[model samples]
Target: MSAQNTQSGKNDKVDDVSGIETTGHEWDGIQELNNPLPRWWLWCFYLTIIWGIGYSVAYPAWPLINGATEGLLGYSTRGEVAQDIDEFREASAARDAQLASADLDTLRENEDLFRYAVSSGGSVFRNNCSQCHGSGAAGAKGYPNLLDDDWLWGGSMEDIAYTVRHGIRNDVDDDARYSEMPAFGELLEKEEITALVEHVRSLSGEEFDAAVAAPGAELYADNCSSCHGDAGLGDRDQGAPNLADAIWLYGGDREALTDTITNARFGVMPPWGTRLTEAQVQAVSAYVHQLGGGEEPAN
Candidate 1:
């Protein structure tokens, strides 16, 4: 009788209305449902699993003790990078080819090529030169402005190229551009330096006491006129700065002038020749020359 009762109880546990079974667990007298997953949800989950397997087989996805998977296609990140570079070079092949053959003058003559070179060179300049020459190319108190007409060295395309290729004041390089302004303080007396400063101020048409500059004129001719010329126009090859010009590479202040005379300042621009390829140097030179205020010097 007990066995029959147990069998009847098991039959009673099954739902009569639906064939779906319960979870066989209950909370607070409520049984949990064991419904099948929705068709769409199940399909999406299956698709992801299959896609993950395919991806793992096709590319480097698996990890091992030594390295990641080689995958079936045998692709490499380095190969992809090289391919990208080759594609870019191919697209700009004409410009690159022209740059290889063209001289600075020829490159400057072509408006399209010049524009392209300048744009590229400007970015390079900012990376390299902006530390000394401000981002705007205005330059610091000690450095010379690139945009201004006043250049310590000749502003010709070749000159600019040389400066970039071999940096000035670079001790490591023997070919680096270098020039030292004379330390006049060692040679001249305090009164004489004062007079000379007054004279220099007069040349620039800045306010200077005539009494002071009168003594300074004699000092100027004897000491400064050799390299700076009698009129203070300066020597291009020697990179002497014109004293008569309003623009001052270093500040025009008296203290600044005194400092220069006391201890000569050597502004060094590195030579790009050793650091960059010929093509890159050419591009940079062309860009600097075209920066406003550069032109053919009067004969």
Candidate 2:
């Protein structure tokens, strides 16, 4: 009977128990039941396709030859960020102007301004000056230690500001602090230089050969005393470093001293006047002055 029904085109079957229709197509006599999708699920799938098309049309979604497509809204995240940065710089301009105009003396009187300068200067130092002066500004072999009272130029606020702006022995600035120490290796005999090194070492209370240093004292008086002073108390005007102090810029070791005398040490610091704004120079100077090494300004 099933075969007669199938041959008579009545094979479109229904499950009598469930009352559901089955697809007429069958494989190995196993027919497939036809099921309709839920209405809510179909609606959700259609809505997503519409949302995607709308989003592509409104925002930058397409690629072009030179750039991305400018969508209907014409909005950009980068443009918004640039605008925000511009606004921030504009807001800070007035404060920056005030800082630039204020002198070191005036800045010190205003506690708020002083604090601001120090904070801002710290950031500037870390970014720009930390490469040579270390992150803590403790200095290295040739760099001067900023935490100590020994300043090759001067440790006063004004002096520090000047040095920072003009720099030392840098050719970039015409008015840069300039000084030169003659390489004594060419002028003096090796024995004489050796004696001078001993003399310099003895000035700092280091043990030295008395016989060698005695003759070295005469040489120092004739050659170094004019700038370094008779007592080795460095002259700021001449930029001569003090030999009497334990703080050494290069090193206090025998080899370091011998090299310095033989070749002469000429450490160069680059001028910040052209690189940094006036406010930044002032701020950094103030920050350095407050670092427990600054001296009272000479009256």
Candidate 3:
């Protein structure tokens, strides 16, 4: 060590105590060792750098001004997904064709088709209708509950299919089940609106003021009877809801009823015919029908 230090350059320092070469730099009392890297470790690092270069050249890499670089192999995630979708559609072509043309009234006679429709409809409902109607199909405020017997429109399988295809109060379809309630805010006084609220409460068997409800009987007869009927049984032909049933799309309370009488409800549903395929519309309609609210076609 002492002989090597004598032969070393002026820049190379030697530690006095250990008689070993130093890097001519120290931190406090310690000096760093300038040892050569292990040959195996160095080779492994070089291989990794080579692999990275090769991977970049052989695969999608390097973002350009317009798009990403395409490799020689020309693989794409979108192309792969599209191929898988095409294959799936081809496999189900027979079933889809049968479903698209099947009659809703007789579709249930074939157990296999019925089961397929129900399952497929459930998937469609979750994907499209669940945002408004709820995941469980229980519905929310202003969205009618599907699990109950009460229905604004007829709930027969055919009726449901028509509704799903054309929708309610939608402007896109000419045959959409159309109905409009005159907004009574300008037509009736505040007291009349309040009376109507109390009367509606009474019709639903809720607690109400008999005095206010008495005046509302005449008011309801004159204004609401045309659509809602004398007993508030609701006319499905006009899409009028049963006020006596207590089940409401919106709340059945005083505040909700008052607002409804004053402004009137103008709920709109988009025609799914424009968006979903015919089979999907029928499937989703069938899905909603079997949710326990479906009714038999009128004899």
Off by more than 4 A, model 3: 1-48
In terms of TM-score, how similar is model 3 to the real structure? 0.86
Q: Any runs in candidate 2 off by more than 4 Å, and if so which? A: 1-84
**Residue range 1-299, candidate 1, lDDT tens digits:** 11122456554333445645566666776656578899999999999999999989998988999989989998889889999989976887778678756777556568888887788678778887788888988887888889988877778776677678777777868977676777887888888898888888888888888999999999999988888889999987777889899788777778877777667788766666777756677777777788885656334
Write model 2 residue lDDT over 1-299, tens digit each, in one string: 12224556544376444556666557786666767779999999999999989988998889999989878998899999999989976986787788899878667899888898999899889988989999999999999889999988888888999999999999899989999999999999999999999999999999899999999999999999999999999999989999998789999888899899899988999999999999899989999899989898887
Candidate 1 displacement at residue 154 in angstroms: 1.2
RMSD for each of the candidates = 7.6, 8.0, 3.8
Per-model TM-score, in order, reads 0.70, 0.75, 0.86
Spell out the clash pairs found in candidate 3: none
Ranking by TM-score: 3, 2, 1
Residue pairs with clashing backbones, model 2: none
Ranking by lDDT: 2, 3, 1
Q: Please identify which of the two predictions, 1 or 2, would achieve the higher lDDT against the true structure.
A: 2
The models' CA-based lDDT, in order, is 0.78, 0.88, 0.87
